[model samples]
Target: MSEIVLRNVCKEYEKGNFAVKDFSLDIHDQEFIIFVGPSGCGKSTTLRMIAGLEDISDGELWIDDQLCNYFDPKDRGLSMVFQNYALYPNMTVYGNLAFALKVRKASKSEIDEKVHKVARILEIEHLLDRKPAALSGGQKQRVAIGSAIIRRPKAFLMDEPLSNLDAKLRAQMRIELAKLHKELETTIIYVTHDQTEAMTLGTRIVVMKDGVVQQVETPIELYNHPVNLFVAGFIGSPSMNFFQAHVTEENGRMVVFIGNPKDGKKIYLEGRRSELARLRAMDQDVTLGIRPEDIHEYADAAELGIEKATVGMNVTVTAREMLGAEVFLYFDEQKKTHAVRLHPKNQTMTGEKIDLYFDPKKIHLFDQNTEESIFYREETV
Candidate 1:
């Protein structure tokens, strides 16, 4: 049961600047955790702290029942897979896998057995005799993983292991990596900047920004209920769209004022009592957030139980991207590039004006001052 507990961990360097601030979490045994964010977000720094490669300036690092803040990386009983293959060019895959074992003084028979077992598990046994240069990128990665797994460490720390691979290969590796986690039953801490990898591979994802942890949650929860504007924008591909708007009570309902007040394109929230109250209580100028898929062509609204909009905006299509499965329509709105996803067969052309509908129930509202989700703050609390 190799659980890890971090209590108010921090990494500070030079003149009180921190690369990781007040970082804390409890990672359970056999869990696949991913640390994700943009460059210089302190995700990799945090992972290095866990691996004992970086100093923790404050707080505690506990692995299992032992304090490991100052423990040597090898003494901490964790192995790491780096982004670079790091295999010796002249060494066969089998030799690279057994090199560490040899350094530890394992007998030849023992080394041979361990290397073959890990090779078989990673499905690279057929290439065991091949040198590093003879293998493809994916094959070399498998060798790197095999080298790490042969020791049977307490946990595996992977630093963007798939970053060097192409798109199609990366997708395949994500699935394999997930399967490996389950089969090994070892705690895994992975770091990457790709949201798709974070969503697909992690059992739990840690979102970070500028040396601070923003949120940690299951993939679906993070995607469905982001806590702030940064998360909502960073988690999804193409991201969520934001519109500057003000909220006010109109008659017995709460309405979101979009575009100009003189314009007739506003969303009405009448029967949504709970959401209405949540908005009306703190209602003011807010950024309205919506996903591309949430916007629908008028003909498709009924299938989703969304009623006809009493008022809607005519969006002029400025660009379109076709992916065979669906189409993304881009339009300029209030000086922003807003997008909507529609069925591929829909004949939306560039420079064409079409009425698009926004689903009020799917809309998210953020406080203009704080840029935080009013609904999420209350729910999380």
Candidate 2:
């Protein structure tokens, strides 16, 4: 296994468009690192640079402590699996897997041994004699992976290898890929635009946007404690709820304004006095962020300090989705649409007005100007 590191790496096209800009990251030995972002983000370009498929305009590329900026792709000791399952249609699965060995003038017996071993590891031994034409989409992908693994490269670069699979098959293959990583124990750098795949498959995820690295962290950490508004908005499934708000002292308490215009509401925050004072002193115009799951149906407003900020408009429930034990309530609130997760037992009506309770401690605050998180610190408990 080998560690891959990129320091101040950059990729620029002739059009003066920078695909990747001063990118720097270290992929530890045997670590599964995923590069994830939206389309047109530099994820694929970054992966291509590591694979030696694209030239690094400026900066260093290191593999196993060796500077490899100019190393040929074959000499990098890495194998890449592309999105399209680049298999030769004329060759059988076994032949495809053994092609590299054959080109290197290995004995037929040696090639056969390597092919069968990889097929067995990938659980595609039964399909060894079948051509790419006869294989299913998932099977073709497995063969592609098998071919990459047979080389025994120090690192694997997978670029959205599962993108073509169906939803059900994608989930199944995700599990299989994770299992394969454990068995092989080789360094892997996967690139994808799918946040779900990045969150589920990667040991660590690097979120990127506009050719710049945003945040890199474990899946749970990224979900719970994103570094900025962009990371917070991009990483979550439902996408975190953001409200433009002002931080002000009200009734001797530091509160965040919802600024609804029609009927503004103030949500009191529960945090250290010092922190609140610091925020106040900075004159920071904060953006209040809350996850849909954090907002609950107000059962007893009196008990939770929930106050009726207004009763201007009743939100009409547009749709309701029952997700087993819980139901997702999609409704229009105060001219803005919002999603709320509620118990399946609570049969809320479509046109009924519901009071939502916001948990102050679970709230996130962001700097309005910088769009950076202001309430992120290592938790004590």
Candidate 3:
């Protein structure tokens, strides 16, 4: 198995600064793991440390049963695909793919066989005669990937290899890469700033922030159940909306009062007995979170068979964005701006006031002080 382990790994530079802090994870065989965060989040830094391109200031890196913290990149039984296509500008695709084998002193026939096999797998056989200058962006990337896998390394590490492609090509290559992972059945560690790429490509995603690991989970889990405010905001496109509210108990239920009750922004959380008890016990301010998909108009909820809107608020459509199948409605309530998604067919007009509903069961509450999800902390505790 090509399982890789990182134990308390850290990368520190001058002046007591660290690029990665106490980073640890287990990447199982044939698993696709993505390290994702905003720029400068240390994802690329971590990948470089794993590839032996950067020195680890502390901790251990193990591949299979071998300690690889001090091993050379070539000796670590791993190959990397980089963001920039590192193909030789002076050589043909065939030469580039066979470069590693030539360096290892493999026989010419052996090199030819491996190169052709990898070219076939990457669907780049037809482009073998082309040089880097002659290839398109996507084709050059394919050649780059083909060259990396030509040696049949135990594991593959890719650092934002698709960032150079256009949106259409990026999407197409996502599918191709997914297929390659399945066929090759090799462990993969990918680093990217794109959450969409992380969600669609990785078997599991590691979300990071400020050079620190925040959460690691499957994409769906990270989406439906984020560990903190950062994960909840980063994992979803259009992000989750947040509002500061005061929690109080009334009539054996928890009422979250946000903005102003006079403005119709107050709502009660129901049906969660344990959560209610916890909220009632806390006299502190809390942050309320709801995804755009969960905020809907009363009629919209009923039409979609969603549970009846537990909380009602009157909001104005400040801005409207039509996205073919769905629309994004931005509004302000209780002095806080928020957005809700609706079917485009609903014909919502800007500047119009309408009553919207929030699904009580779908709401997320976070501690204002820690910015951690209350639900997540409760479950883990």
Better of 1 and 2 by TM-score: 1
> lDDT by residue for model 1 over 1-381, one digit each (tens)?
699999999999765898899999999999889998889989888889999999899999999989999999989999989999799888998899999999999999999998988888889999988999999899899899999999999999999999999888888888889889888999999998788889988899999999999999999989888988898898987889999887776775677778666786677764543464345434678888889998888787767656454356788999999999999999999899998999998898999998888887777777877877766855544
**Model 3 accuracy (lDDT, Cα):** 0.84
For model 3, where is the 10-residue window of minimal lDDT?
Answer: 273-282
**Per-residue CA lDDT of candidate 3, range 1-381, in tens?**
698999999989765788899999999999999998888889888998889999989999999979999999878988999999798999999999999899999999999889889999888899889889999999999999998888888999999999999999999899999999999989999988777788898899999888899999989988988988889888887889888776766666666666554444556665553475355335567788899998888786667554342556777799999999899999985476788998788776998987777766677777777888877745443
List CA RMSD, all candidates. Answer: 1.8, 2.9, 2.0
**Model 2, global lDDT:** 0.81
Residue-wise C-alpha lDDT for candidate 2, range 54-138, written one tens digit per residue: 9999999999999999999999999999999999999999889998888889999999888888888888999988999999999
Q: Return the top candidate by lDDT.
A: 1
Rank candidates by TM-score, best first.
1, 3, 2
Clashing pairs in 3: none
- Model 1 TM-score is 0.95
Per-model TM-score versus the true fold: 0.95, 0.91, 0.94
